[model samples]
Target: MIAVFDRVLIANRGEIAVRIIRTLDRLGVESVAVFSDADADAPHVRAATTAVRIGPADARRSYLDGAAVIGAALAAGAQAVHPGYGFLSENAAFARACAEAGLVFVGPPAPAIETMGDKIRARAAVEARGVATVPGIARPGLSDADLVEGAAEVGYPVLVKPSAGGGGKGMHRVDRADDLPAALAQARREAAAAFGDDALFVERFVAEPRHIEVQVLADAHGAVIHLGERECSLQRRHQKIVEEAPSPLLDPAQRAAIGRAACETARAVGYAGVGTVEFIVSARRPDEPFFMEMNTRLQVEHAVTELVTGIDLVEQQLRVAAGEPLALTQDGIRLAGHAIEARVYAEDPSNGFLPTGGRLLDVRWPADVRVDAGVAAGSLVGAHYDPMIAKVVAHGATRADALASLQQALSATRLPGVTTNIRFLGRLLDLPAVVAGDLDTGLVDREVPALSADPVPDADFAACAVHEVPSGHGAWRADGWRLAGARGAVLRYADGDGEAVVTVRERDVVVERAGSRAVVPRAELADLEVRAAEDGATLWVSGAAGDRAISRPALVRRALRASSPELVSPMPGSVVAVHVADGDEVALGDAVASVEAMKMEHVLRAPVAGVVRLLAVVGAAVVRGQRLAVVEPPTDERRP
Candidate 1:
């Protein structure tokens, strides 16, 4: 297996790039990384053999710019380009351009991409092959008026999205006739912004369906096979959260049927390289599966398949791209013990799962599981890319064993600086439904309250007081003062939970709150890093329990931001939309503007019902807390 290509250019960023580089290195194939200004110091860039500055922080000008990627590849003297799952990975034109430029595109052929990349066309192809598809209306030249009528025929609840979209971008669930038009418009907006194509369609919305997909591998020699099934039903916002191989919901007959259908669908489109054929399995009709869509590139959840099969999908992808036949046949592919993967994101589970941006102070992954990470302890998470920080996959001999390992892995995963969904994932894993292997796409949203509920232990807050309380401002810094003088510091947050005064007596931390006092272990309070730099107060504690943090300086910054005249960006990102104008009256909960960063959209809302004064324009770059619009209260309800 002489190296297929001397050097392969990784035409993306983040964890996927890191994952690909590891395989390329093992194959003795050098890797070149292309990045924007936001990723000058990213782990993936450093991991590659060499790196090139593609463009600014905005994804369109850098990662999504097909020409720039190819130019960088040529300049780096790379023989091939590996579009790592996102950005331009599924762009057929990009694939054609790479071929036109004499560079090997490490993915499906352009014809196959053009065929399956469009959901409308993919559905037609699959349906022609006798594959079952969800009830829907989609085709070129389909009118909005016709779609509204189509919705009536399809039923009240349906999904609207771009014909050429993946992930959850531009996808909307409309449950009412009145909401259909608005949903379509918003879906088109998102679709256009994400894929540059706004041709929208509608499909019957499946109620609480299981998202299962089959991994398919093919070669130029015409060999193709399915690598079993992956249960990707655990999701939120239509994005997968947890994935496992050899779906617990599938028996031998169902598995064989679905696998055959997937391979049939792949071979139908002349599919090559590695791909995933996703299906929606209704809870009511467990044995029947509906063809949802096909991802022509490697999937984010491909790791679970690798863990179960003990084969490197990336290596196989590379070999296929080099025109080599797959080294293994379907008979040789074996699925062993159960494997589970959990995606760790930079999001606040309690706050409507809003995307979070901040500096990663400390990150420690569990040593037992396989951790694929994109950031380091000092890495900065911005509103310029996807918010996913890492993925943890645990494998065991049995499903129960795998889940136990996954639970422990989540507990051992530590990311103290920025907010994360670790606590939420831990709780989700403990649910009875999950324990019993009964799951659906609606599980997370249905149990939001309990799933996101996180109660901080008293000791964790005491740790925050020790690290965040200013050195001299807090009496705790003073040794037990000579006489009777009480020494303590009051630490408060914007949260409704109020404040607490921590009194330092000898080596112990006495947390006094609501007229009650609880002693905290002195050692527990001093376990992790504490820093109050120009950014903000950072308090981190990683112990046997888990990682937790609350930056008081960040709260103060928010307070100062609230003092401004307008609602502002919660994080730094480019303004994609503005819905209000100067002097326009608006109500609470109205979306005044939408800002996007790291592939997550944050909708700014009116703080008070009043006249709106716009301060930011669409496409304007804004920073954290940058004012976007000001809402003036009515004369009778005005506040100073």
Candidate 2:
């Protein structure tokens, strides 16, 4: 059948928008993309057949502007609007607005969205229908004291979940009454910031539970089916970083049970298009699961489900919205081989996994894997959206094979500019628990100490000889440069906070303080750090240590920047809020100010207790390492 709409407007940004555009293109349907000023040149905007500017960089004025988005869609002659996940995907008002405008909303019914959008209402709805829900309060407004009393009744160690949002924002675990108030406040603030809703619902915190979610596709007709289940147990900060379909923990019987339950929930809600039913699978119980929440939109890890199901869920969404019956049934659905997806986010796992922003100086991926990338080389991972830059999915006959293939893909992938969780993903895939398919929401958190404890390779300096001078030096001369008095001269290199010197003499290289040495071949002197034209030679001159490669120039520049004794903005973003001012005394680790980039908040904190001298004001823009404030230690204070 022809597409339900001649053109569907993708009211979103980033990889998901691009992903939907690709599907629309494949279906011979024209695609429209509405981008904010911040996303004018984004890959999604470029991929769309028609593009329209909505508003400024601020999401509220742009992506979150329902009227602006509707206007853009109508102006572009779009007959449908696809809110790809976040912004307005589950917004009942937006759904109603689209319906009133006579535009197809590629999602569940507005009533369904309204009913399930609030976690509290969703819990009550599912519970009333006999679906198991975590024990908690569904009521909205109550004093903190009353809420604490509710928590006591429900039991301590309750989870404070924002009733209005998803993606783990404002999700807090309260173990004590004192912590409940703070958790509730923070949850409200984050919920308001992320979803424009501060209402929260308290739930029983299921300890060490595996997050299993069923992907469901329903049509305007009565057909509803489940596309197996995804194991989303591996996460940090409640955001799923790694996901796989056909959870290892579930047997066929259990899978069928969960899938049936997911279908039942969708059937009860009259859900349409694509949605997910998330459940917390107790590690203690294993088979029995409690309903957590439902996402009435496409998911970030949809690729893995697609890989296993061989169904174009987005196409199904469009078709379902187009008034067509679901093409497949639960009887037709069958899980294929295993597939694993690792989200490549622009974040530094070492530093509390804070979002990192920068122009992608270099971005390359392995050819064998399916890479749903949102950014290319030169693409700016700004501070106005989620930091997920790309998703790499690999499919294989077995779970182990899929994991291995994904590991190879991640290891081979290179993203040089901003700090990424690529290396962390590789390590995560290798974790003993991860390898054995033993996982829980806390597995990643539990392994943090070991994952981040490893120091940068000691051979980093020697490796920089290659980073400093890439191949093609001496005008195609492979021989090392001849110094005035030596075969190869000593060069300085920095790694993190330390510096090292390496002496290269033609075919031989010597390290000063490392007490390690490796002899280089005269023909292959560009080892370790430089990529050579195909010769089958090893990249690094392997010594007793591991093969290392690092950019000496980047490291040296980093070292020079770190010499400053002032707190600075970590990336290019606008200072949205400030907490401290000049002459304000702050203790170490106190948040002095916060900058918003890529929609993620980066709070600048005092590294040491001192009097702060503010340099940047709220609403001002700052670049990476630009001083935001100078802290004067009291011990070193001047008399004057």
TM-scores of the candidates in the order shown: 0.93, 0.88
Best by TM-score: 1
Q: State the TM-score for model 2.
A: 0.88
Residue-level lDDT of model 2, residues 215-291, one tens digit each, is: 99988878888999999999887889999998999989999988888987887788988999999998888778899
Q: How many steric overlaps are in each model, in order?
A: 5, 11
Model 2 regions more than 4 Å off = 1-3, 453-455, 458-460, 467-483, 512-565, 574-585, 612-621, 634-640
lDDT of 1: 0.83
Score candidate 1 by TM-score against the native: 0.93
lDDT of 1 at 383: 76
